[model samples]
Target: MEQKREISDEQRFCEMRATVEDCNRFACALFQQLSAQNSGNLFFSPASISTALAMTLAGARGETAQEMHNALQLTQEGAQLHAAFQRLLSETRTGGVELDVANQLWGKTGYHFLAPFLETIRDCYDGGLQLVDFQEEPAAAADQINEWVSRATHGKITELVSPMSFHELTRLILVNAIYFKGAWEDEFEPERTRDQTFYLAGDQQTSVPMMHQTGSFGYFENETLQVLELPYRKRNYVPQFVENEDGSVGLMHTEVPGGGGDFSMCILLPRERDGLNDLEKEIDSATLQTWLTMRHQEVIVSLPRFQLELEYELNTPLESLGMERAFQPSSADFYGMTDNPEGLYIDAVLHKTFVDINERGTEAAAVTGVVWAAGCAQEPEPPKVFCADHPFLFLIRDRQTGWIYFMGRFNQPEHQAD
Candidate 1:
């Protein structure tokens, strides 16, 4: 008899990491498509935006691969050929820009193949991304996608799509879908949340709800930055913090020191809202990676908490940013896979996200064994005042794979849901 092979814990962990990585890559491609279409309206860095796209792709249906190829006029073999074509496209570009090739392929094919994925996402986002597929009439697909954008984002985002035309021989559809909903771990009491003065830049201030709290929580501080962890009403929802050297703050996914298990929420509440612009200009992939590897010393953090909800539609923005080749049936040459290749084309890509942050903590809570950091400092530091009043970018990412699950900016807070 053959000996039974046992799966080790590390092997299981690696498998999970792969699943998350695949999802992240797919979603990042979709995000690239969105960014390509909408040029200047977004706030996150390109890499952060890519991570958000990865998060969305995690929710896509497994059948999407087959459906997408069929719509594009490619067989499994043909799709593989198209992928090879993309590889060649990458080789043609110089420097890190080569990665843009992946984004281009996603932008082109993601939109066309996204119908079914959108349908699944609609149910996930509470009736967002509704597109009526009239088999007999076959109305303009762009129009349908636009309608979904209008309804899902509560009208904050309009015209996510435009009229499109393709050669009858090459038009193919690819679908990308995403679904995310997170609540605070500690619930903010509506009564406790009171309108307080929020300090904006340049001696500016706005009255906003400032949720107050004091508890034994995860905290860290250093000469360059201060850190804090605020759990939502749900244990699963924990937002981490990273205060910068200049007193400005930003949000980051909290990971275990030494690269252990999953990630936690970390939001860097910058001292100045406008400081984000300068901060963004200085940020690059390497900067972020360096920050994560830093050794933190004795730290304590206290933060005033609040709640927020946000949603976005990112298709139109992606196409306008130099990725039009993938969407064009004539220009798209995905014929390497099958002999019966009439040519493969792409249709559309769609994404939706929901998050609620409050004083009570996150809505989804998960209890797990905590890994203690050895020789770390104790004692909470005086809480730095950080409030998100103006426009700011946010992202959700997987700790292990550095995959971004969601990315968007909160431009108008009033439009957010409860």
Candidate 2:
């Protein structure tokens, strides 16, 4: 038996960095597509979605593999991407924030999946494969998956998989759930909150409770828009040196004492009352990279307290992004996953997300289930006003890694409690 070679720290860091970069680029592309399809509020976690699909990518082969690699903006090799995810996920756990990410694979009882495929997900994603009675009890299988997701997300997400989505023919289902709750480093006072008129598209307006605050924040602005960074309180973590089995010391990176692991909500506020559409049209990965280069300064800010829940059938959107063959039952190729003559193809890609931002901070949860029934910043200058009085784009991200946990457009504010 050949012993597995241990990966060096430098190699691990490179892979993790590549994965983060790829996911960020993919997030921008997907956001653009979603914005084009939906006119109202749009919210989804590109991290959660990409993680789930990357697990599925472990089983993809031929055109299916190539298309997924293209759509995902993967820069690393197939097997290396999984290892990078493992490193990235490990880093997330060390961040001193209330964040939890869970991944699991549900397989029909007696169904045969390549052992290497299951092992890869288990080792990299911590996504253990569980045998379920999808053949005899599809509903029960879905409930089990949902129950696990709910637990992983601390009840923030309950139903990730619908029984209607899978049937007796279902062979596999891959799921990823992420829950994040962070308090603002500088919180908005409830006393300062007041109802404000938020201008909507087509010269419409609605009253919503807007949180106001004046403090030193990361801020930047140009002729077109304003960028604000509201940081989250970080938990302190100490690094430990652990002796490896071979008696060699390895650096533990569970939490960086004060590195990029700090979480922050970055808001891109349009200068004009209704310039979100224009901003969306002009923004991409490179554009976003430039906008995040902000400086710190004292600024006044007014942001609407909002909550949004959205669910989407991602099959069409993903197909439109160039992974069309994976959805085609006859043409799909997942030979890497299973040797069964009737190859598995993606049946449906379900995504659900919930986000609430208020005076305190932000609490967000997202779940992505890839049913393999077939297969699937910165700132500060002067007191630049960042009044998100109209439509804007917001995302919660890891500063060091540039990993976007949740990204969306906040259009009309909904009536909700703070």
Tens digit per residue, CA lDDT, model 2, 1-418: 1124479889878878889989999999899889989999999999999998898888888988999999988888666777788889987643556888889888878878898888888888888889998767878887899899889878877887766767756888888999998878777998999999999998899999999999877777899999999888765667789999999999886643342338899999989987898999987888998999887788889999989989988888898889888888888999888998878999888899988898888899999988877432344345767788899999999987889999999987778854
RMSD of each: 16.2, 6.8
On lDDT, the leading prediction is: 2
Per residue, candidate 1 scores C-alpha lDDT tens digits across 116-169 of: 333322322222332233222234655554444444334433443344322223
- Single out the weakest 10-residue window by summed lDDT for candidate 1: 366-375
Q: What global local distance difference test value does model 1 have?
A: 0.36
Q: Each model's TM-score, in the order given? A: 0.48, 0.91
lDDT of 2: 0.85
Top TM-score prediction, candidate number: 2
RMSD of 2: 6.8
